[model samples]
Target: MTTVAVFRPADERLDDAVALLESLGATPVPDPMLEVDPTGVCPREDADFAVLTSKTGAELAEAEGWDAQTTTVCAIGDPTADALRAAGYAVDVVPEEFSSGGIVSTLEGRVDGARVEVARSDHGSDVLTDGLNDAGAYVHETVLYRLTRPDGAGESADRAAAGELDAALFTSSMTVENFLAAATERGVREDALAGLNDAAVGTIGDPTRETAAAHGIDVDVVPERADFESLARATLAAAE
Candidate 1:
């Protein structure tokens, strides 16, 4: 059985990823790399459009009683859209590309001369805001949360360093960065990176793939869809 490493936050998402791996016959190493630290902030109410980049952002926004007022709501992907809808917010846009660049494209012509509010975590890429600004939209970003790596989060790094991990699913660039931070803290950065490179690795999107590449980690798979199941199955197949 493949021994795979995952780094989702400690939540239903992590549980679901583990369950999915088990259902697929892989032994999972659920090493959560992110812990959400809510910033107690919400989207600005005066914007013409509001964009949510993650399910966590949507949940936080909902908890803050964010009202659309006169703004159109948008999500970066189906997951975020579902979360917003579940919270009783009407999702008006979900880009086909399911990424910052994709959302930029989706709102390009429409957002010209519009006030766009972006609600997301602290580590959100500048691409979206810059793209929107360049496209003639006044963009304001609210940091809804900050992602911090939990203490003692490097066990999977040790396992990887020992050549025991068969695959790794990197859902975001921050996961890759936090995983490296964990490995470095364990004093196994070099060995862990070497072993990790030997195993099959999948990144959910191009941004994550690029981040891994910048660190000299060769990503073996990047599924067509930027989702966990697709990334895991594709990486496991590559590992075999």
Candidate 2:
């Protein structure tokens, strides 16, 4: 069976990812590189618009019983929008492009002179706020969660360095950074990268792909759709 590495948070998300890989006939190396640390902060109810960038963010916001209070809700992608809707929030916008730039483009004209609340993880890209600002939206960011690599999480890094993984899935730029950090901690950064280069790599989105590129990692798969299942299936299929 093809051996694949997945770097989701050490939660139900990781379990679901592992199950998906197993169902696809791949041996999964479930090394979680990100852990969620909620900030106990909620989006201000006074904003004209609110944005959710991840499913986790949607869940967290709902947990807080977040009342948009007339704020139009927007999500960057379908998954996020679905998450919001499932949480009983009415989604008013979701960009066709499924990215920060895409969302900014979708709302640029309408958000001018409007207050936009951004609720997501600490690793959110500056491209989001900058573009919103450039478009004349008053943006306020509320960090719903902070992502940190779990301790003793380098098994996949070791496997990658040993040329044991057939493919690897990176969901976010932070996951890529944390994976490389794990390799560095094991003093196998260069070797691990070499091994990964010999295998297939996939990133969930363009920002993640650019991060991998900046770190000299070669990406073989970037699905037309920005979702985990698509990313994993595409990478595993490429590995085969």
Candidate 3:
């Protein structure tokens, strides 16, 4: 059986990553590198616009009672938009690229002189802020959640060092950083990465791939779609 290393944060969406691995005939090694903790903050419901980059942010918005009836809601991707819709928010914008650049493009003309509120992860891209400001929107960015290193981070690093993992799935830049920290703690940072160099390296999107590259890991598979299921299929194919 193909043992795939899962290095995403432990969250509601983690099950989706595991399920994708199973569907692709891979045994998931659950060594979550991070966890998302809410900052108990929300965007202004009275703002002219709101931006959401992740499901966690959307959930936080819902918890903070951010109604979208008056605010123009913009989501970075379909998943985020779906979360908002499920919470009874009407998403007015969804980028085609599912990145900060995409969000910037979507709000290019509409944000000038507007009050834009962004509820997102602490580690979210600065592109959105910069873009909004450049477009003359008074932006208020709130840290909705933080991604911190979680337990069992060293498990996948250890397995990689032993050549037991067939693939390593990286869903975020934070995952890459935490995985490396785990490997470093095990004194197998080089060996683990070397082993992973031999195995299929799966990345969720361009940002994760850039993070992997910064660590000298040339990704073997990058999903055409920036989602876990696509990442799993690409990893399986690359491993084959």
TM-score (all chains, Cα) for each model: 0.98, 0.98, 0.95
lDDT by residue (39-145, candidate 3, tens digit) is 88767777899899888788888998766788888998888999999999888999888888888988889899999998888898778899889999999988888
How many collisions per candidate? 0, 0, 0
Note each model's CA RMSD in angstroms. Answer: 0.8, 0.9, 1.4
- How many clashing pairs in candidate 2? 0
What are the Cα lDDT values of the candidates? 0.94, 0.93, 0.85
**Of candidates 3 and 2, the better by TM-score:** 2
Alpha carbon lDDT at 28, candidate 2? 97
Q: Which lDDT tens digits does candidate 2 get at residues 100-196? A: 9999999999999999999999999999999999999999999999988899999998999999999999999999999999999999999999989
Those runs of model 3 whose alpha carbons end farther than 4 Å from true positions after fitting are none
Instruction: For model 3, give the 10-residue run with minimal summed lDDT.
Output: 7-16
Per-residue lDDT, model 2, residue 164, is 98
lDDT value, residue 111 of candidate 3: 90
